[model samples]
Target: MTVLYGIKNCDTIKKAKAWLDNAKIDYTFHDYRVEGIDADMVAEFFAQLDWQNVVNKRGTTFRALSDDTKASLSAETALPLLVEQPAMIKRPILVHQGQYHLGFKPDQYAKIFASA
Candidate 1:
């Protein structure tokens, strides 16, 4: 099964959901805000994607972080932070057939689905 992880209100998540619906792809939406994310889950993401790819540096949550926290970010440091504040994760992480894709783009989805 395909699972999409993100916050509900994010514009990118909204667009990703719409794209999935329009493509008629069957998927499960896992809202981090509502469903909550765990350390193990965050670790799984890190295993598939690099910390930079998974973390949303552009978001307000990240911007609000202390300079020390930002400068000291490593997988170990960021993992706990990501678990504590799931909104800092990049939106719409798609997991399908044990493969992971971070963020979204129509062409990218098309390619992924086609190759699948």
Candidate 2:
């Protein structure tokens, strides 16, 4: 089964949800804002994904962070920060077949989940 994890109001998350609906692919939505995220899940994503790719450094959330918070971060420091600030994460993390996808694009979705 596919599980989508993100904030409900995020545009990318909305788009991904809509695309999944349009495609008639069944998925469970896990709103991080309401449900909350833990360090282990954050670290799990980090384990499989490059920090530069998975972290939304350009986002307002990251931009608003203190210089020390951003500067002092490495994998060890970043994981807990991600747990504290879910918005720091890139949206619409899709999980299926024991794999994780950090974000969504229509074409990429089409190619990746074509058989589903």
Candidate 3:
């Protein structure tokens, strides 16, 4: 099964969606913000992903956080904040056949699908 997780409005997500559509790969999209998130889902996201990669430190969401919140960020502390604010998570995490990938690139998508 192939699943894509990200906020719908993200430009990166749009690019990934377009790439998938053009590639004719069917996938399920999980918008963590609107659909909400649970511990299991969050845990699954972190299974192969590092907190630094999973968290979008460059985005406004993360930038707006209090210094104390930012200072103490870690694997243990990230989950609760991710549950409360999914935007803090990076865009377009593509999971294919149980393998997880973060962000989007045409070449990367092509390679991933080609391997199938």
Candidate 4:
């Protein structure tokens, strides 16, 4: 099954959801902000995806961290942080056919779902 992970109220998540709906693509949205995230799930993502891409460095949540914490960020440190603070993760992580896609854009979504 395809899964989309992110905060439910985020604008980028909204756009991604809309695009999926318009394309008639079925997806299960895992709202990390409210429902919480699983460490194992994030760990799986880390194994296959870049830690830098999974951790949203540009978000206010990440920027608000202590410089030391930011500096210490790695797959090890970021995993627990991500599980504890879902907002620190980039928006709309689309997972399909066991592949992870980070962020959102119309063209990106189009290509990601082209095989769906």
Candidate 5:
């Protein structure tokens, strides 16, 4: 099974969910706002995927971070920040089997899911 992790209200997440449903793909949704993500889980995700892929620098949540905080972000710094703020991580992290995908792009999902 695949796991789709993101906030329920995010338009990107909604699109991702709808795409998966339309494609007849099964996925489990993980809402960070309601459930609150864990540091350990973030750390584990980092371990499995590249730090750059896991972090969402383009998001408003990232832009709103303190300059010092954003400037000092190394992989180590990023992991904790992402844990404390799940929004810092990219939206709609799709995990299937042992592979991980960050963000939701229709073409990208098509490529990935096609292989699955």
Candidate 6:
């Protein structure tokens, strides 16, 4: 089963969901805001993706963080932060067949599914 993780109101997540629906791909949307995220799940993402790739540095959530929090960010520090504040993570993280893809683009999704 394919699992898509992100916040519901994010524009990127909206676009990704639309793309998946249009393509008729079956996937379960894991809305971090509504469903919440856990440390183990965040760790799983960290195992497959770099902290830099998973963290959304440009988002408001990250910007609003304390300077100490931003400066001290590391795998250990980020795990709890991500679990507590899912908005700090990037949107539309797709996990399929044990493979993980961060972010989304039509062509990228197409290639990923084709390769799968």
Q: Which number leads on lDDT?
A: 1
lDDT of 3 by residue, 64-101 (tens): 99999999998889988888889998888999998999
What C-alpha lDDT, on a 0 to 100 scale, does residue 73 get in candidate 1? Answer: 96
So what's the TM-score on candidate 6? 0.95
Candidate 1: residue 74 Cα off by (Å): 0.6
List pairs with backbone clashes in candidate 2. none
Number of clashing pairs per prediction, in order: 0, 0, 0, 0, 0, 0
Which wins on TM-score, candidate 1 or candidate 5? 1
Q: Flag regions of model 6 displaced more than 4 Å.
A: none
lDDT agreement with native, every candidate: 0.93, 0.87, 0.89, 0.87, 0.87, 0.91
- Which stretches of model 4 miss by more than 4 angstroms? none
Report the lDDT tens digits of candidate 1 across residue range 3-82. Answer: 99999999999999998898899999999989999999999999999888899999999999999999999999999999
TM for every model, in the order presented, reads 0.96, 0.93, 0.95, 0.93, 0.89, 0.95
Poorest 10 consecutive residues of model 4 by lDDT? 44-53
Q: 1-116 in candidate 2: lDDT tens per residue?
A: 89999999999999999999999988999998899999888888887777666788989999998999888878888888788889988987888877788889999889779766
Worst 10 residues of 5 by lDDT: 43-52
Task: Kindly indicate the candidate among 3 and 6 with the higher lDDT.
Answer: 6
Clashing pairs in 4: none
For TM-score, candidate 4 versus 5, the one ahead is: 4
Clashing pairs in 1: none
Which has the better lDDT: candidate 1, or candidate 5? Answer: 1
Per-residue lDDT of model 6, residues 1-116, tens digit only: 99999988899999999988988899999998788889999999999998788999999889999999899899999999999989989888999888999999999999878865
lDDT of 5 by residue, 1-116 (tens): 89999999999999999999999998889998888888788877788877878898988989998999888888888977887788888888899876888888999999888977
Top model number, TM-score: 1
Q: Any idea what lDDT model 4 has? A: 0.87
